[model samples]
Target: MKKLYSLFIALAGILCFTSCGDDYAYTAPEALDVTKADLYFKAPGGTGSIEVKTDRELQATSSVDWCSVSVSGGVVTAKVVKNESIESRAGTITLNDGVLTSLVAVYQEGFAFGIDASNLKTLNANAADSTSVIVTSSSPYIVNIPSYAASWLSYTADEDGKVTFHFTKNESGAPRGANVTISCDDREKSFTIRQYDINSFVGAWKVSYADGEDLYEEDITITSPSTGALYLNFAPLTPTVTPIFHCTYVNGGLKMANGNAQGRYSSYYLFTLFSSTDGYISWAATYTYSASPYIAEDGTFYMVFANDGSWPNKETNGVALGAFTSATATNAGFVGTLATYTDLVLYK
Candidate 1:
């Protein structure tokens, strides 16, 4: 027992001496080490912290007002601000622990207006009703479309908060395409649009031709609607008739089957030259097929409505004509047609 007691006493003394070997306070570390890949800030900015390892108190600060940093204990906290400008920005945060210093990169993404105008797709020439497209944007935006496209495209407003795409009929014989771009917060988004040919009957033309030994000149105009309704107009007609004439365009061609007749065309009053003495028969609705609309690479529209049949008065024939620039279409020179006349030719 005495030997055991002596051994215990010796062990206790040794343990006490080892426990009291050193009495030192916490000391500052030699380096500051941060462990984080990167910091991402949302719009305006946010607050976040990262894990750091160091024994001494640290100090932190930002290079720009967009970001700010502070240190508490072993961690570094940052306060990020959202970018109000359209452009994205970047900055840096520096941390120092007495003996060591470190750099951290802080990035902020650009502001988003959330503007989208990708709904519109295609257009038609003789459509009666206008087309529509919805626009979504939280911030202000600018619209950019080609001049030619803008001439026929617009915004259709029915009620508040009801956004629509409004447009006119494409009277050009050729098809065209355009791109609409929206600019927001210095960002850009583009959408594509297309227009189908509404044929050469979409413009005004000065009609000049020789009837027998006498020559007569007439003015004619054509219009296209958003509801696909195509019509033509003349100065004055006999029998007190309306100046507007309803017409049809189909499959890249024109059809005037009984244009001034009854039933389907009853709502409109046609027949521009209805005087039997005038000897210039108005366009008929029968067998007036084989007509097509075409456009040259120079943006000129032309039409071909020729038939190998004779009319009642047979005065002005060969309905082939080109789009009018100023007053007349000089491109159509000598169609060499006399469908309603004995010998007639169309010259520019």
Candidate 2:
């Protein structure tokens, strides 16, 4: 019985050894392969295909929303839309056969589309007879005109991406603005046109001033004389007198003139009585600027005032002085009592 048992053990050991040898000699299955691993499409994209050389069932997917992929039998197909941008794009198709994976590179040509409207983003035109603005693009684009603005403006586009806009005379007394849209494929750009009347600055304005130490605000009336200069009653500057300042259009801004330049006020107050407080009379008040002041298109006004020996003056703020304290100090007028008034901005 022992010998029989020994023979049984030997048979079992031989079976184990044979199984181990077979394990060493075995080979894994082949990975997924493709006949064509790369596919290219034109700008007007269409379907592309790659032949799979694997016996296993294959699954395919795309990496980009613009590209899609499918697997049928041993073939992988990719479909893509037209590339409408100036840049070229690429994507990949992933193929998986359970045990191994492969990637099929997909390339598509991009259609050029761009608008060079940076230089012509904003255009200002007078109420003259006619005016035109031109823009260039890489591809032809569609011009979207507002329904209200169609009567005054017209456009023409060429195949080479040259767009021209023609505007007729603006009979409207008020300033008018319009925005035109330029679109190519899914991309869009816009530009604005503003037409101004000759007397656009004739109206009421809200004025604000930053005079270094205090902020003075008031509402003023602006009036223009037929064709030349504009005048506004600025009460905040000259409290007891009829405050009026004049400005002229120059270099797209309203250039201001000093009170003396208008021949209505003196260069120096020269002991003028402006206030009386607690039996004390304040005298010799003057507004002076170191630099020429101007009003910008966006209602921004800038001025630089000279330092009045007592207070520091800035671009937006200026210094003023009370020449005398009372009748006893009349000889000490314009000594050192300086108050500053600076940035005087006006907006409608």
Candidate 3:
């Protein structure tokens, strides 16, 4: 029995050693070359493959296995099992069974101009990485700011990365400066304003006889007599006035002089004046005229003077001559010819 036990023990030991040898754990193949290992995709439930080459032939019992593959945060990763084959195979073989990972980066495009409250345009953004758009103005506008206040305006950005701004005008109702601001990405850009002139106030004008019997009967174009000089010629049949006839602009109001005879002479003279607000002018004058009087459509002045010595003796009613039909002043002064009439000489 002891000898039989000994033999059994030996057999068991030998069998254990043989099984251990045959069941050796697989190790990743060394010196294996990755010739064409890259990302590849297949249909669902289909096997994906990664090709690799080896320096030697792999045993038939060995096999290659892919452990895992993944892509995240713009990066790709792959875990592969080295050669499972006992005998190495040369050239390239396909690797399958693990996920393949790859990475892609995110891109953005944006722009902005102007202010937060009265923004001209809001910020803009796009995913295409590049884009462009046009802006248009809706009105001819005037922005006013007090001289005492800070002239700079404010602006802000929109969600899409666009910005807008507004400008203030000066006391003269003109834009202060040409500078406009564009705010974007915590930065600013400036543009200039287009300026315009107030040249509409300078031009030419005329006067004609209106009222009973004289309605449109006498048409006169007071021609330019000299620099800042005007001439009025009466029709051959029209009545004449005294020798003194003066022409001047009062407070920007165009006026003509009317002279007095004998007891009728008063400190104030009637003036034929032109209105500044509207084109309508009338006859009015205080004995002592105001300086630089701002003329209005309702304001008046007259052409006061005696008609003749014979008519002067009688208690004659003063007449209100017609308003100024036209009056023109220029930087170079008045232009044209003076008219000639008896009894009335031109007054400065």
What's model 2's TM-score?
Answer: 0.46
Q: Write the per-residue lDDT of candidate 2 for residues 132-214, one digit (tens) a residue.
A: 34444433467887766777877776555567676777665544556677776667776666565437657766777665457
Using all chains and alpha carbons, the TM-scores for the candidates as numbered come to 0.32, 0.46, 0.19
- State in Å the error of residue 230, model 3: 2.9
lDDT of 1 by residue, 1-348 (tens): 011000001112222223468744544333356765246665556787756678878887888897777777877788887588667777777777787877666777667665333554444454534544554443446666666566776654333223455566655554544565666556776654545656444667544434456776667776886445576554553344334545577755554332242111123222222212333334344524223443333333344444434344333333321112223213232122121211221111
- The window of 10 residues in a row where model 3 has the poorest summed lDDT is 1-10
lDDT of each: 0.49, 0.54, 0.27
Better of 2 and 3 by lDDT: 2
Which number leads on TM-score? 2
Query: Which window of 10 residues has the lowest lDDT sum in candidate 2?
Result: 1-10
How would you encode candidate 3's per-residue C-alpha lDDT over 196-258 as one tens digit per residue? 112111122222333323334333334445444333443432233322223443322233443
| TM-score (C-alpha) between model 3 and the true structure | 0.19
Candidate 2 residue 101 C-alpha distance from true site, Å: 19
**Better model by TM-score: candidate 1 vs candidate 3:** 1
lDDT of 3: 0.27
| Candidate 1: Cα lDDT at 50 | 58
